[model samples]
Target: MGASQSDNAHLSKADVVSRIKTRLASADIKKAQEVGGIFLFNIIKGTTVYSWTLDLNKVEVFEGEPEDDPDTTFTLNEHYFKQLVYGKEDARTIMQAGRCSVTGDIMRAMKLEPYIKLN
Candidate 1:
């Protein structure tokens, strides 16, 4: 359940990664450690949910539930997350509906609010 590049009107996980990587390319995760979150990147691992971290230069990829209480956690299907990359839904609203949950450091998560381009 993903969009093709030819479509040019949709987005895929790759696209989401591209966007996030782009935004985080220069972001110093270590310096931004004050902004602590589980940073879950849910990817399809052979029909299972695979979560990982995208903090700074360290990518602590792993399986199972997150350890720390994330500032915000995005609970979305791969397809929906991709749609977010394509600007199909409003991140703020999604968060409001409990699709995305922020447990701690809400403001820090909010700081990442504007960076998400949900079109």
Candidate 2:
């Protein structure tokens, strides 16, 4: 983990989002199905905020929020999101420290680590 510090240190929100989209799209649904739930991400960048949704139930990840309420919603800035995806920070720790805002089914939020984490 230490050897790749520089690689992950410069990681951007776009890079992480592209990776997640690609990974989730190619992911084996049968296994991903085990973590079923809709997770929404609000990624802030300056004055712009982009929203993404990971519908584990459908085994898909897409831009824009879901039609209905998500099982969990995570709101954080682009920098923090990149950090989260690269495992530079823990989701719970960020939320606890007010770096991230989570709404609904907070405990289930931890299950999202695998889905977002970059290898």
Candidate 3:
């Protein structure tokens, strides 16, 4: 059976960040350690671009820039970002297909998939 409208709901960037904060309130940071690495996600919607940093060491997601440089930075449009968070798309494949761009260490960036699944 198909999922109801609510089950297939897509989260905005703000929604995804809020969801991460909610999860951290309950789970320990160590859960993040399992996923490893830090990433700064730059989601672009048209000319509007916003950034969020995913720091597994602290298990935190916050808007704007990171305290220090991130291990990897991922730049994708809002559409591809939704796919990433939903685990319906792979970041590596997205990069390969030119749907997204990654900077810094890609192997470390690849470590982020499990964290996205945590969403």
Candidate 4:
């Protein structure tokens, strides 16, 4: 099932980061290691910015810019980021609408869908 409205409403950037970290650490994400690389998520909420990184075995979430270069970077507003994660929004639709922007390796970004259940 998709995330509830109330559930989504209560989520903060840090909550989302924590979810990603927990999700990636699960045994379910073992297959994700195959397509892993340094991925950076740049989420903007009003004037605030939140960033997180995923590199195969580890997931690091922090405020501000990533310390190292990312193999793939995803830029989007916090709302869309939550929507995507909660299965309330379609990644392709958002990307097509220009609401989501990606840089670096397109294929690597595509590979992340399975891990995030965006597929």
TM-score of each: 0.53, 0.85, 0.80, 0.81
Candidate 4 per-residue lDDT, tens place, 46-114, comes to: 897788776754444354555668888889998888878777787888888999899898777776764
Inter-residue clash pairs, candidate 4: none
Q: For residues 33-70, what per-residue lDDT tens digits would candidate 3 score against the true structure?
A: 77666788899998999999888877777898898888
Q: Give the TM-score of candidate 4.
A: 0.81
- Residue 8's lDDT in candidate 1: 37
Clashes of each: 1, 0, 0, 0
For each candidate in the order shown, give its overall lDDT on alpha carbons: 0.52, 0.83, 0.75, 0.72
lDDT agreement of model 3 with the native: 0.75
The ten-residue window of minimal lDDT in model 4 covers 56-65
| lDDT winner | 2
Which segments of model 4 are wrong by more than 4 Å?
1-3, 28-30, 57-65, 117-119
- Taking all chains together, the TM-score of candidate 2 against the true structure is 0.85
Q: By TM-score, is 1 or 3 better?
A: 3
Ranking by lDDT: 2, 3, 4, 1
Which pairs clash in the backbone of model 2? none
Rank candidates by TM-score, best first.
Answer: 2, 4, 3, 1
Q: Which sections of candidate 1 miss by over 4 Å?
A: 1-11, 26-38, 43-47, 56-71, 114-119
